[model samples]
Target: MLKPLPDTVKGPAMRLQHMVMTFRSALVDRLVAHDPALSRVRMGARVTLSILISIAALIAFHFLVTPLPSISYALAIVLSIEGGVAVRDRTPGEQLKTRLIGCAASLFCISLAALLEGYRLVADLAFLGVILAASLARVYGQRGFAVGMFAFISYFMGAYLKPTFAELPLAALGPLFAVTIGHLVRTFLFPEDWRRDLRAALKAMQGRVMDILVRLSVLSKEGRVTENDRTELRHMEEQLKDVVLMAEGLLPRQVDGTAHSDDDPVTALSMAIFDLHLSAESAIVQSLETPPPFVLVHAVISGDRDLAEKVAASTAVEKGGETARASAQALLWLQRSLQALGRAAGKEAGGLASIDDRVVDEPPTKPDFSWKNPLVRAAAQITIAAGIAMIFGLFLSRERWFWAVLTAFLTFNNTKSRGDAAIRAMQRSVGTALGIIIGLAAATLLAGHTVSTVILASACVFLAFYFLQVSYALLSFFVTIVLCLVYGLIGQLTLDVLLLRVEETMIGAVAGTFVAFVVFPASTRSNVDLALARWYDALGQLLDAARDGESRYRVIELSSRLDAAYRELTVAARPLGSAWSLVTRPGPIRQTLAMFLATSYWARIFAHDFAEAKKPLDPDVLTAIEEARAALSKAAARGSDCFATRKPRPVMAGNAAPAFRQGAAMGADRVANLLNRLYPA
Candidate 1:
């Protein structure tokens, strides 16, 4: 018989059990997040096209024609793809064009690197030139990025093998055949339309926004909201909106037989929805962060029918007291946002204007070419890394030298941040090791079975493309297996070759990491101040707009600011978090960002309160507002100085106005708290 448990023991044990259960549930939820755009059926279709031709050749030839040729072509077809680089993107035609172009360019570069291999001076210059070309190709967008990658890989292989003149033609034909087959298979056989995916993303975002709005409506009725009532639902809404914009950017740009007309209007509608959601979030946050009145909440609920009806209903509530007036203004602002969203989805979708078109002939204009551009600087840095790595590769491992240079070029990925380069190099090293081991195992097990080799290669290619965005380690694993099979079919698999390849890759990875960290380190920490400044400026602009009674432009500015500030902070934080040093981390920047976001929430409410005023504020309150604004600005400046200098400064918490502690006083206190937290001792 079990004895009765003590109350103290039971209570804590039950609480611990509940926590473990909750954590387990959350873990499962997170595991299934980010659903794959392609269904298993669709993936199987892609797999069939990728390998069916090779299998047919094997069956028809019956060993008459060697499996090596078809295998090489199959490898090319599998690797050369738009989907191989990015995901859920609907630009098959564009990818085909860029990949094919890259294929041709790579063939030329590979041949050139081979012929000039003996001449160190000439070959080095050629390598530099091709690398530069690859770097600049990114100006053309994703297609160019693919081209750069393919070209770099080709050059690496050519330089590594140092093939004879007789071997060049065969080398060129393999990729040409693969590219032809890949395009045919992708274009005619298993065509993917991204419009459906885009619609799903848009609907998902809209649904989330509607849910948040509904929740806020219910909460508003309670009329006594605490700080905990403010949820991260707004942050989630922003993330969803970001996903929609990112998906839109990946849509097909060219007008061809495959392009759909309906996508244009729908694309516009998505952008409008994203834009209006920004304002809606700001307004709703103001109303809910500090509850206004039940009348305003009712106005929002009542106006949910249509734009006109909502606006008219909000106007009816404006005639009450000052509290009711502020609530009415917020209701009108939110309702107008909802109306614009409806218009965007309905008849006026095309008329919902934006600064840029969804699809354009030319790439968006960026800053003119300068060394200041991270790409240009990276080109210079990579050139040096390659040149130095080549020397080590030639002297230490002449036959496998290309692997080192390839690693150096591949490591950077033409992306910003040294931290990213370091991380990528590490991933590649780990992935390649696992991939090579598994690939060799598969080849050995399936030896002498040509059809088996083809089947496994095809499956590996399928899985590689599917998991490309999901994990670099997984991609590297599959890619290595496919290449190992192709090479094994050519009868080139040997212990010596395997060991040499591994050694060269390791060398390259170390060299690449060294270059990223030491020689030309562009620490994101240096840019932390600039990112903070951008956030501050955006918040200041929103406050000014609200104070000036320009709600439309104010909301627009707020939306743009939300996008810009968040993007900058994200860009800065990723690298900072991954930084090599313990001191140089994102913790500080994230802390500052959190405090700013919190302080700004109250500031937005304060702005709306003043903006909705029909008459001038009392002199006493006006004075209080001015003092509070100064304190907030001063806090921002101090935070900037502390980050730049890495020294603690005195913290100031703006004093609350004795008379209006719940209004301006409450907001001012938050600003002061932010200042203290932003640069704590």
Candidate 2:
């Protein structure tokens, strides 16, 4: 390096390097966000564990069954490991519940599928029924998800494993055995604490938020903001939003007989977790354009307890610019909230902040099974798709029609939109093809050895779970390899089988994708708009709660919900944010989004101030808020129509006044502007 560049060039280079680092951070977070040790667990360690388990399982069970069931149990072990490993594993009870239900449902489906194998018409109809039933499983929430997943797997195995009628019904027990072993390994062998897991998740999220604040402080020191800085800021906003949701999800569930008294510290902390996230989100938004002094912000982010309290004491009444005040407030609230969380978690204030106990518990309610439910619609549509795929599969190869049927059953299983289905279809095809190629090479390279097969299968299974949620493509690849290796374990891995698997999957996946497009197709754009519209509608409900003046907590709680929904809607419509950004300069759409954000900010301000008010708001003020809610609701409807229908709605003139309500009026104006821009008057 002969010479250094000017500040201009150096700045850009620095920004590029920072952006790359941020991207790397995002990737790393995606890979191991759910579990910390998972990312650190080396490939060698995984392989060692796999080989040892294979040796033990194979030696014991080799005489009873061939490599197939032994490998199946190993598969279960890997699944268990995916749930939890060592004592670092968290949520043993929840994992057990999920595994138990999934096992039962899977076993039943496998048995039923085997029974229906000989009856071609009846088999097709039965599969259709299973597909629909799996789709309808969403009504039960987490239980439903587990059941649906196991149901699909069971259906796939029963349909494809080709268990002969001569074989004992014991064949159906393979998955049951696999899942049971998986649960045992996860719960008894490598148990995880749900509260600890939740606590860890929360702490990690808090740390990330701190990192963001630190980064912001460093940037603020430079005193010059660039487009790259803005981009990075936006990325931080998004990441924070995601992490906030993740933290909320980790809140300890109410357990029966727990000391969840209203005044209990843990109970209050659990409830306040929602508030923390909302406040943190609001803080992130506030700090983007304006940051406080680096020292002040840094002390808070660093969890310097005494220093943070000093900063809060000094900054609370200090006369400063609005931006500086907002920044100070954001940092103070973030610190206080996280500190409270730390104390409630019964851990070091800055060390980990993981909860080891739960104090809140509520009785469970019966699940709704109404036909009008979205889950029912999902079931009906998915059944139709599966039926179509079955017919297509028979057309492709009656001998291997199960593959096609399996693909259809898998595609629409849990996807919320046509884009999701289409994406899965593409991912499955590409991943399967790549995985098959790798499996074929492995099958050819080392086909006869039991240890080799198990080892390879184990590695694939581990990686499959590793990338399970991180990337569909990678997950599909490893899953395909594991499936093929399973075939190899049975001494049936061949070119003909591999090619047929790929071909039939393509057929089935393609048919399911087609059905996804044709039958009740959910467009991503439309869904986003609808979600946003619903968010706005919820805002109205929030104000109504506030206006009812019955309880201040209701108002606070509703406002918190509004904040959370707004964040969700913002995340959901990010693609539109890209298009809305292309206008090159500040424009109506851009302004509108900003106005909506501003509306949220002002609304939060009102709620925050109202929280301390001893009496209800004036009637006139309540009337003003009601009027604002109605106007905002109408604007949302029109915006939805503009998106849902390819038609534009005429803007209606509406009266608006109160300063706090002006942002809502502006939000309406932006909606109108966006409608005109996208659909035209």
* Candidate 1 local lDDT, 344-462, one digit each (tens): 55533233233232353553576335867766677777877777678777776766777778778778774456676777788888888988999889989988999889878888877
What local lDDT score does residue 313 receive in model 1, on the 0 to 100 scale? 55
TM-score, each model? 0.64, 0.72
Give the alpha carbon lDDT tens digit for every residue of 1-681 in model 2: 113333554577786776677677777675555454343234223433534454465456645764343324433443334323221223566666776776677667766877888886787688777777777776777667666766765666567655665442445345444555555554454444445555666666676667677777776687555668666766765565565556555555445643334454444554456546545655655566565666777787777868865765574426656655766777787787777766755633322244344434445777777765656666776777777777877876777787777677667654666656766777788999999999888877777887888778777766775565566688779878877877887887888888988888898788878877777766656656767776777677666766676455555555656667767655455434343222223233344444455555556545555554546576555656656665665566566443333322222111111133332233333333332333344
For each candidate, the alpha-carbon lDDT, in order, equals 0.59, 0.60
- Backbone collisions counted per model: 0, 4
Residue 76 of model 2, lDDT score: 41
